[model samples]
Structures are given as structure tokens and as C-alpha cells.
Target: MRVAILASGNGTNFEALTKHFQSGDIPGDEVLLFCNHPDAPVMKRAERLGVPHESFTVKECGGKEKYEQRLLKLLKQYKVDIIALAGYLRVVGPTILNEYPDSILNLHPALLPSYPGLNSIQRAFDDYKKGKIKETGVTVHFIDAHLDHGPIIAQKAVPIKADDTEASLESRVHDTEHVLFPAALKKVILERMNKQ
Candidate 1:
């Protein structure tokens, strides 16, 4: 299936997904990268990986509806069947959500139903520092209109060590994310293929 990735910052997850698909670890067709920030590093990564990419600002499109309309148009042009949100900061509107439905997935740093929004890794680490929680991990789920409130497809927890700092915990969580995101996508792909 054709896959598109949306990213806003450092595209480590984007790079991981590209590499996974390149290595035949996951079944997907050409990947197109989309970035909200024109100067985002993800564009560079996409170029390096030889993937098609586009950068746009919501303001430039006049409004969310127009921006989403443009994005939807692009996805349709590529015949994209799946979308991955990797560190993509903007909340997805119904335009794309309705078009893709459960086909769009996002990877969050902390296990969902625990920390559900931005700065999740840092927040979870802070909670651990305060002895409020013992562990945190990553979650992969469908993208809904709600922020990080979609149905979870997969999750893996990582225990926080007493000596773990926020940075260390975050590193481990990122590692978990790299592994889990592709696995989750693979499951989604297999299910879609089976349904067809």
C-alpha cells in the first residue's frame, strides 16, 4: 500500500519508517513525506531517502479546511492508502480523518490512557521523578479528531529505573517507538490486505 508520513520536527520516526520500508521489513509502496514547517529536517531526510515531499503552512492555505483539502488532494494524487503521523504537531482535522478513517496512525512517546498529549515523555518522566509512576512507554493508535484519544492498536511499556533521568527515559521511549511503530503499521497493513 502507498504510505505517506506527516512530520513537523526532527524526522527520526520518518527516517525509521523509510528505512523499514526500504529494507522490506514492512510492506508499503512509495512514501511521500509532508511537513508543516518548510525548514523542518524531515524534508531533508525525505530528500536523502529519495522520497517525494511537500511542505506547507496552515496559514498559507487560508484555513484548516483549505489546507486539509490540499493535503487530501495530494494524497489522492499519490493514491496513498495509509498515513503515519511521526512527531507531527498539528492536530488532524476531520477532512483527512474522514477520508482515511482508521487508516491514519500516530505514534506517541508515552503509553496512552496515561500521558495523552504533547511533551508526554517529559511529563511521564517528571511524574516518575515525583514517584508518581514507575514506568512509561510508547503507543501506536489510529488518529481521531481528538488529541491522542484514538483507539490504541499497540503499546509497549518500559520500566523507569531509579537512576533514570528524563533524557534517559526519553531515549528508551524513542527506541521503543522505533520498533513499535513499524510493527503496528505492519499489523494495520496485513489487516487491510486481508480485508480486501
Candidate 2:
């Protein structure tokens, strides 16, 4: 399936997905990258990986409506079958979500139904420190209009160590994300292919 990744940060998940697709571990086609920040490092990573990427700033686009319209146009131009959000900070508006619906997927750093928004990893770590929970993990889920509240596709837990700090916990969660996101994408793509 054709996949478009939207990221606004380092794009480690984007890199992982590209490598997985290159190795034929995940069946994908015509992968594209999109970022809202003009200077986001993901743009550079996209360049190095030979993936076509586009960026738009709020001021350049005028507003969210026009920005998402341009994004929709690009998605259509590339015939993207799925939209994967990786570290994208902005909340997707109705324009894209309505257009893609269940085809859009996101990888969250915390197991959902608990820590659901920004700084989830740190929140989970804090909760653990307070003895509120023992483990936290990554979740791959379908993206809805709500932030990080969607049907989960896959999840894998990482136990909190007694000596774990926020950074170490974040590292382990990222490792889980790199693995789980691709697997979830593969499953979503395979299901799409089968239904067609």
C-alpha cells in the first residue's frame, strides 16, 4: 500500500519504517514524508533516505484549513492508501481525518486508556515512581479526531525498572515503537489488500 508519513521531529519512526520497507519486511509503496515545521530534521532524514518530502509552515499556508487542504492534495497526488503519524505534534483537523478515516494510524509512546496525550512517557514514568503502575509501553492505534484516543491495533509493554529514570524509560518505549509501528502498518496494509 502507498504510505504517507507525517512527522514534525527527528523522524526516527519514519527512518525505521523506511528501513523496514527497504528490507521487504513491510509491504509499502511510494512512501512520502510531510512536516509542518519548515526546519524539522525529518526533512533532512527524508532527503538522506531518498524519500520525497514536503513541508508547510502555518504562516506560509495561511491557516490549518489551507494547510491540510494542501496536504490532502499531495496525498491524492501520490495515491496514498494510508497515513501514518510519527511524532507529529499538531492535531489533525477534520479535513484529513474525514478523508482518510480508519486508514490513518499513529504510534503513541504510552499504552492508551491511561496516558493518552503529550508527555505520555514522562507521565507514565512519574506514575510508576509514585507506585501507581508497574509497566508502560507503546501503542499503535487508528487516529481519530481526538488526540491519542482511537482503537488500538497493537501494544507491547515494557516493565519499569526500580532504577529507571524518565530518559531510560523513554528510550525503551521508543525501541518498542520502532518495532511495533512497522508491524501494525504491515497488518493494516495486508488487511487493506485482502479487502480489495
- Candidate lDDT scores, in order, read 0.90, 0.90
Predicted structure 1, TM vs. truth: 0.97
**lDDT of candidate model 2 versus the reference:** 0.90
Per model, state how many residue pairs clash.
0, 0
Candidate 1 regions off by >4 Å?
Answer: none
TM-score: which candidate is best?
A: 2
lDDT string for model 2 (102-188, tens) is 989998888887888888988998899889999999999998888898888999999999999899999999999999999999999
Q: Could you give candidate 1's per-residue lDDT for residues 49-166 as a string of tens digits?
A: 9999998999999989999999899999989999999999999998889899888999988878888887898898889888899999999999888889888999999999988888
Name the runs in model 2 displaced over 4 angstroms: none
Scored by lDDT, model 1 comes in at 0.90
